[model samples]
Target chain A: GEEVAQTPKHLVRGEGQKAKLYCAPIKGHSYVFWYQQVLKNEFKFLISFQNENVFDETGMPKERFSAKCLPNSPCSLEIQATKLEDSAVYFCASSQYYSGNTIYFGEGSWLTVV
Target chain B: AQSVAQPEDQVNVAEGNPLTVKCTYSVSGNPYLFWYVQYPNRGLQFLLKYITGDNLVKGSYGFEAEFNKSQTSFHLKKPSALVSDSALYFCAVSLRTGNEKLTFGTGTRLTIIP
Candidate 1:
């Protein structure tokens, strides 16, 4: 694919339910990133992967949030026991390399926790 | 640590007038600056980026940004504002080495008043 692709454009999940989002990076892109955009429009970096390996997980919430990018599969971000605060737009981005490369973003998956 | 700041929450410009959105950054080493625009209910679109070499870099939709190392700023500019240009603009920065994650500013909502 030429652009980053995200699944389930909109997802409405009840509080305490689980929400899962998927992303497929552009072809040949080795690095994948996930960001959360809240209603305030503040973008919070969640996690990143370098060729299916966890490159950074400091920003991820260890208790309930988890993500994975395995070879030959679309990357996944899963939120367990979702809360109202968890409602946000999840954006998936990708880049060819680590430095000085332009990162392209997907259309984003909207998650609404009711 | 790396961070970006967009001083203004909102900026208004009359159609046909020049427009400027302010941005400042702080990083450990050299900075990789970028500007992105988001229309209502749409994904972010890349505007421009300042990687190295020239201080001024041009990008899509007639947008340009000037990288000022002394001031640690990358301000987005356009010669003339158009009604269609009204959108939310974000400024982001990343380190030239080590981290590949982009730290984005709060974002500036630009309105091109007719």
Candidate 2:
């Protein structure tokens, strides 16, 4: 694909339910990143992958949030036992290089935890 | 660590007037600066980036930014404003090495009044 693709444009999940989002990076891009945008208009970095390996996970919440990018599959971000604070728009972005390169973003997945 | 700051929470300009949005950054060394725009309910769209060489960088939708090394600033600019150009703008910064994640500013809401 020419652009990063994200699945489930909008998802309404009850509190304590699980929410999963998917992302397919643009063809030829090796670096994939996930960000969470809350209502405050702040973009918080969640995680990033280089090829199929985890590049950085410092921003991830280890207790309940997990992500993976496997061979021949779209990357996934899963939130277990979602809370109201978990409601946000999850954006997937990709870049050909980690430095001095343009990173393209997807339309984003809107997750509303009620 | 790299950080970005967008000083204005909102900016308004007449449709025909020129517009500017302020941004400043701090990093240990040389930085990679970028600007992104987000329309309502949409993901962040790449506007422009400043890697090296030119102090003035042009990007999508007639947008441009001037990077000032002394001021540590990379402000977004447009020759003329359009109502359609009204959106949320974010400035981001990343180190030239080490970090793969971009640190984004709080975001500025640009409203072009008709």
Candidate 3:
């Protein structure tokens, strides 16, 4: 069984269109984090959730990016008005502890914006 | 604020030879370090972590890392390299604070020569 699951493994959208990615963290895991991998081999911190509540939203772009982890539903990361620079692989991960623990990641959702 | 640095852009090792990937970090208070491997177009796979206690920690695929508190470094090492080990390696760190997100390095590409 896969510990973390991400849906829509690959997606394509034209500029100005909206894009959304979903993640299901491992059961019993309380901490979930999202990262964006850009073409320069850089991993940018996006946001994180502790259960259904957000623990950090510092890295999220307030104008276009939003995420939510609702009770009994998968965590979602949504982007409005996609831009060419937004094309990247978005990773979702979960860990038992925020301080010191192994964070397991899903396969990632690949977004291609034109 | 916490941050990780992988000084090398790439590392090359011959099969059966020893390999080392360097990582250094800066953070307030005690640090939690982690190593992850990523193949092309895939999510990161956890390799190992150093929370506390022992300076040396063994992890998946015969890999290990040495935690040097004085140097603020946690470098990934393997006694014997394999061609299959070719991938992108990431070093990450998190502060002792319980709700912060992990800060990841840019990533080091490892090429194992057969």
> For each candidate, what is chain B's TM-score?
0.97, 0.97, 0.97
Worst 10 residues of 1 chain A by lDDT: A95-104
Best lDDT goes to which candidate? 2
The digit string of per-residue lDDT tens for model 2 on B27-106 reads 98889999999999888898999989989999999999999999999999999999999999999998787446889999
Model 3 clash pairs are: none
Candidate 2's displacement at residue B43, Å, is 1.0
Better of 1 and 2 by DockQ: 2
Q: Which of 1 and 3 is the better model by DockQ? A: 3
Model 1 lDDT tens row, A16-88: 9999999999999999999999987999999999989999888999899999999999999999999999999
Q: Please identify which of the two predictions, 1 or 3, would achieve the higher lDDT against the true structure.
A: 1
TM per candidate: 0.98, 0.97, 0.97
Candidate numbers sorted by TM-score from highest down: 1, 2, 3
Candidate 3 C-alpha error for residue A58, in Å: 0.3
lDDT of 3 by residue, B1-103 (tens): 7889999999999999999999999988888899999998789999999988999999999999999989999999999999999999999997777856779
In model 3, state the lDDT of residue B81.
100
Between candidates 1 and 2, name the one with more favorable lDDT. Answer: 2
Model 1 residue B111 CA deviation in Å:
0.7
